[model samples]
Each structure stands twice: as structure tokens, then as C-alpha cells.
Target: MKLPRSIRVIERGWLSANNIVLEERSEAVVVDSGYVAHAPQTLALLERALAGKKLARLVNTHCHSDHMGGNAAIQKKFGCAISIPQGEAPAIDNWDEQQLILAVADQRAQAFSYDDTFRDGDVLQMGGLDWQVIAAPGHDTHAVMFHSPEARVLISGDALWENGFGVVFPQLFGRETALAETRATLEAVGRLDVDVVIPGHGPPFGDAGAALERAFHRLEGYEQDIARLARHCAKVMLSFSLLEKRSMPLAELPAYVARVPILAELNSRYLRMTHAAMAEWLVNELERAGAAGRREGLLLARGE
Candidate 1:
């Protein structure tokens, strides 16, 4: 799919969310600055893309580590103002690692201040188009997506991926409305007149209808079995850690899961397995799903 000449999508790997650059007349705006560990690369890429134009602002769909980790670096390098969803402003301002899922999930993001926040119904002019901010609450209760009606494009930040949406973390944490909110979010996406969807972690894709169908089906499965959702979340968290660390010693994998608050909570609440068993299951699941592989004494990230 051909995006507007003013808009550029930099598809990143699973460890980092994709970065979208919106070129304006004199300055540019960036959406979602990949993971903190990849900040240097992100800056390098933006330098080439922006050429000599100044970066006016940096915006985020949500404040997840992978999606907004590079905020501090970007702001320091370009002197760009940062904006985030109004719902996440408090967490960001307070630097609450628990609420941000950084400590809970064993993830990391640099603390950064935002100049402003946007809410649903707000219109942001980017790349010469007015993109409407839409609330998307499931993966992260404060997450949002952007849709440009004139361009028929949607920047879905882990809300509605081509194969499936992001993990509903609230559900695993015992939020009764999480599943329903996910359904509502998907239904809302179904109502949009979108020709292309630029997801947070994948390449831009067309065929929004098919993507919604797949997301709905996946949601239905999660609705049927909450344990299934927990297991999926466990695998995802583990795979993400593997991606960040490259490899982990097989002997320490069990202790690693036990030490991580989210993984420990998931095992106690849903899986109800011993730490060793949980680690074994996670390793096997990742290998089976082609997300990880066991080599010698290490569990290595695969197909990232």
C-alpha cells in the first residue's frame, strides 16, 4: 500500500514498535519512538528521513515501553515537544513503573516529560492531514489510535494488528471490563473507513476487514478461555524479554520467571504451576510457536 508522500513508516522488529514520521512544510512530527535500547538507531534513521528539517513534536499512541522508550533521547536530540494520551499523562508525569508495566513486566523505558496530552475527539494535523485521535482501551487502558478520514488510513498502535491485537493486560490483572473493552475497540475499528492500517509493530497493510475478522476471532477465543489469554501473555512477555536479552541461560529461566512480578502473578492466578514448570512450559511454547529456540544451554530469541 502506498502511504502519502508526506508520511513515512519505519517498520521495526518485535522488540520495538514502528515509528511513523509525518513531514510538514517546515518541520516534522513523529509518532511512537521505538524501544530505549534502540534509541541510537532510531535517531540515526530519523536523521536520514528528516534530512535537515526540524522535528516539531513527538506523539505516542500509548506509553508502553516499546512504543515510547525513545522519547527522552528524541526530545534531547531534536528539542521536540512530546505529547501523549491524556489518560496516560498521570502515569508518565509520576513515572509510575508499576502503572507503566515496566517493573511488572521486566521492561524498561526512560523517564521523560510531555508538553501536552491529547484525548479522543481531538484532531491533530500531521503530514498535511487531520488525524482524529480515537480511544483504544484494552491492551493498555490508556491506549489510543489515529485515523485520517480524508486519507482513509489508520495508525493502529497494537490495537488491531493484521493477525491479532495486542495482549489485553488488564484482563490478566483481573479487570472485568478488559475483554469487553477489547471487543468494543475492535467493533469501533470495524466501523472506520480505512484503506490502510499502519500498525505499531508490523508493516503497513491494507484489507482492514480481514484484519478485524481475525482480531474478532482471536478475541472470541480469549473470551472463551481466560487461561488461554494468560498463557498467551506469558509467552509474549517471555519472548519479548528474550528479544531484548538475546539469550538467557536455561538454568536460570525458571528463577527469571519467578522474579518477574507479572510472570509470577500469571502463574499464581491462572496457570497455577510451579516456577520450574512455568519456565519449562514457556520455553516449550515459544519454541513451538517459532518465537524462541533452545541452543546448548541457552534459550535464544528466534524469528524476531
Candidate 2:
């Protein structure tokens, strides 16, 4: 489906979330800056897209490291006002690494402040369109999605991807409501009149019906077996680390998993495997999924 001319999506790889630009007459608004490691690239892309037009604001669907990693850089370059979900205000204001899952997952994002906060039911004007803020609480408890009813477009962050939504981190952390919340989020999205989806990690897709069905199937599997969910989270965390670092020494995998708080916690709670075993299992799983490769005593992130 063709997106509105005012909307532009800067598709990115797994390490970073895609950047969405809403160009107005004299100014523009950006949604979700990419990962911190790609801040320079994000700025370069924005410079080209904006073409001297003012970037009036930076908004986030959630507070994940990958999604908001380049916030500081964008603010520094464009001096745009940053706005985030109201639920995330406390965490972002304090720069709580644990609450934001940065230190917990061994991810990094430069701390940046927000000028305002938007909550569910709020309407934002961007690119001459009215986008309604809808609470999407599965991926991140406080996450929200923006939908433009007139444009029939949904900016679904990690909440609802084309294949499946993001890993339900709250479930891994023993939040009993996570699975239900995920299901509810999907139901909410299903109620929207969305003809196009701008997801956080992948290209914009028009098959919203098919995507929701797949997401429900994935959620059903997780709901039936929490252990499976734990394992999936572990593999994702490890893969993200590898993506950021490019490659890790084979010999250090075990220690690396043990040091990362989230990985270590997952191993302790659900997997209950020796650190070495957990590391080996993660590498094997990632390899089987084509997310990583081993060569010359190093585990390298493959195919992004």
C-alpha cells in the first residue's frame, strides 16, 4: 500500500528501530530515533530527508533502547522538542537504566529529557494529520501506538510487527498480565481501521489481518509454555548484544551471559542451566535461527 506523501519511513536493521518522518510545510516531526550506535547515521538520514526543514519534535512509542537510542543526538542537532509516553516519564526523567532495561539487557542509550508527555486518547497533529494515541501495553507495559484514522495508517512500534510482536519482556519478568495484555493489544489493533502498518523493526506492511493472526498464534504458544518464552527472550538478548558488539570471542560467551543481568536472571529462573550450558544453547539457537554465526573462535552477528 502506498503511504501518504507526507510520511517517510527510514527502514533499519535489527539493531535499530526504523525512523518515521512526518514532513509538514516548514517543519517535520520524527517518531522513534534508531539505536545509539547508529546515531550518526540517523542524523545523516534526517538531514537528507528534512533538507533544511525544521525538525519540530521527536516522539517515541516506547522507551526501549533501540527505539529511542538516538534521542540525544536528534535533540542536539535539531533542538527538537522531545515527547514520550506519559507512563515512561518518570523512568526517562530519572534516567533509570534498570527500569528502561538498558543496563539489565546490556544495551545502551544516551539519556535524554522530554519536553512533554502524551497518553492514551491524546491526539497529535503531524504532517497535517491527526493521529490518535492508543495504549499498547504488551511489549512495554506503558507503550503506545499512534493511528491516523483519516490516513488509515498505524505506527505500531514493537507492539504489533508484521510476523510477530516484540518479545514480551514483562512475561519473562513474571508479570502475570503480560500475555493477556499482549492479546488485548492485538485485539485493540484489530479494531482499528488500519490499511498500513509502520512497525518499529521491519518494513511497512499492508497485510494487517494476516499479521494480527500470526501475532495471536505466537502469543498462544507463549501463553501455553512460559519456559519457551524465557528461552526466546534469552536468545533475543544475546543476539542484540552480538548485533551491537558485532562479534564476541567464543571463549567469553559464558562469562558474557553470566554478567548480563537479564540473561543471567532468565537462566536462573527458567532455564536453570549452567552458565556455560546457557551460553552454548544461546549460540546454538541463534545459529539455528540464522541470526548468528561462528568462525575463527568468534560468534558474529549474521544477516543483521
Candidate 3:
């Protein structure tokens, strides 16, 4: 997996978004700060990657907690200017937990301020390479992807993964345009002359066309049955919580699901199961998927 000499990809596990450090001359730019729980690790990686150079800027593709949770810590450490997608600017400025999806999902991310915001079609010069910011509104309505023409590389933030795109999150929020936007976003990516794609959660891959085909296939299934997508979202949220908490008492799991707003919404809209039932189902599903296991009286996250 040889990447351009100027950019370094720090592939964080599923709990944290990958961080891309772009170095040019004496300054550095970091994209996506990862989850707050891993802020210290993110900083250590940056320190090693940036060496003695100054971190000049930090940019986020979306307001997702896994991607932007370390903003405050990084800002405090480097005094770097922060840039975020324009659509999430107001949420960040107001520090409204309810407005941000992180809060809705019951995820934790320390509030932080942004120095500026970039809109779709914006061009950024980082690591002496020109990258264009393009709107990607499926996984996140305000998400953006960065494309470098010379390198034929794209930083696809949760928009297009090697296996499939992220969950159509807007659909869960009662937005009907989500499927259409996702289809359009995929088409837009298809039009780009990309040789490599750096996805938000996976390792960089070179087969953009094949990945698109996979994404389209997944989209077709989701379009046909949104219940499937909602189920996936439920599992993902539970998996993420497990990844963060490691384990929880079996008895407490029900109340836990009931507490998260997004989990409750998923239950009410699609699953329609009681919180206890949802929690039990989630645990069973996780165990079935080998993502979790039961030990004694506790449900333990897998591979922990």
C-alpha cells in the first residue's frame, strides 16, 4: 500500500476514524481527529508523524464524532487552525448536542470551535498538492470528499467504503432524499478519475470501479428494504458502543439501549421492539456475528 510520499494515513481501528497527516515543507495538516476516547493516541500518532514540524491546520470532512471527536485536544495541543464542513459550522458554534448526530447517537465528542468552514467545490492546498472538496451527502448530508487530481486519490470520508458506503443516516432521520443523494454521490465518484480511495474506516484500496459496484449493489438492497438498513444501523450503533465500553452487564443492556436517543428511534421506527427486547436481540446478533460474546453475567465485546 504505497501512498504518495507526502501523505501519511494512520489507520485507526473501527472505534476511531483514520487520520491523514499531510506534510509540506515545515508545516503539517491533519484530517479527521478520531474519537475523543482515543485523543491521546491520536495526538501521539500525530506527534510521531509530524516529528518536530508544526501542525498548521486541522480539517474535518463531517461532524461525526468518530471523525471529529479529538478536535478540542488537538487544537489545544498545536494551536492549529480548524476547518470543518460549512453545513456543520452552526452546530459546532452553538455546541448543541441535540443538533449534532453524535449527541443523537449517544456518542461522546468534546465540543470545539472551528476557525473556518469549507463548502463543496472548495480547493485546498496541502502537502504541496491540490485537493478539491466535493459534496457527499449520503452517509452524512454535509460530508465532503477530497480529490487530488495529480495523484488520482480521493479521501472518501464514509461516503464510499471498499465494501459499501456508510449507512444512509439521513433516512433514519425521516429524510426521503437520502437514497437519491447516495446514488448521485456514487455517480459523482464514478465520474472522477481516481486510482486510489482512502476510505474513512478501511485501508486504502486502488480498485475504485469494483468498490463502486459493491456499493451500488448494497444500495440496491437497501433501496428495496429500508428495514434492512435500519437493522444495520442498530447493529452498528450497538457495536460502536461495545467498542467504546468493552462490556456491559447483561441486565443493564436493556436500559442502556433505552437511553440512547438514536437507538430508541430505531426501535420505534423499524424494529418496534421494547428496549429490553432490542438489547437482547442486539447482544444475540453481536454474538452471532462474532462481534461480541457472553462471559459470566456480562456481555463482552469481541476481541477485547
lDDT by residue for model 3 (169-245), tens: 53566566888899999999999989889989889999999999999999998889888888888999889888998
- How far residue 298's Cα lies from its native spot in candidate 3, in Å, is 1.3
RMSD of each: 1.0, 1.0, 1.3
lDDT of each: 0.92, 0.93, 0.89
Tell me the lDDT of model 2 at 126. 89
Model 1 misplaced regions, further than 4 Å: 170-174
Best by lDDT: 2
TM-score per candidate, in order? Answer: 0.98, 0.98, 0.96
In candidate 3, how many Å is residue 113 off? Answer: 0.7
Per-residue alpha-carbon lDDT of model 2 for 1-304, expressed as tens digits? 9899999999998899999999989999999998999999999999999999999999999999999999999999999999999999999989988889998899999999899999999999988899999999987889999999999999999999999998886345546698899999999999999999999989999999999999999999988899989888888899998999999998998999899999988888899999999989988999999998999999999986
Question: Which stretches of candidate 2 lie above 4 Å from their native place?
Answer: 170-174
What is the full ranking by lDDT, best candidate first?
2, 1, 3
Output candidate 3 Cα RMSD: 1.3
| Candidate 1 structure quality by residue, lDDT tens digits, 1-304 | 6788899998898889999999989899999999999999999999988999999999999999999999999999999999999999999989999888898898999999999999999999988999999999899888999999999999999998999988886355556688899999999998899999999988999999999999999999989999999888899999888899999999998899999999998888899999999999999999999888898999988776
Worst 10 residues of 2 by lDDT: 167-176
What's the TM for model 3? 0.96
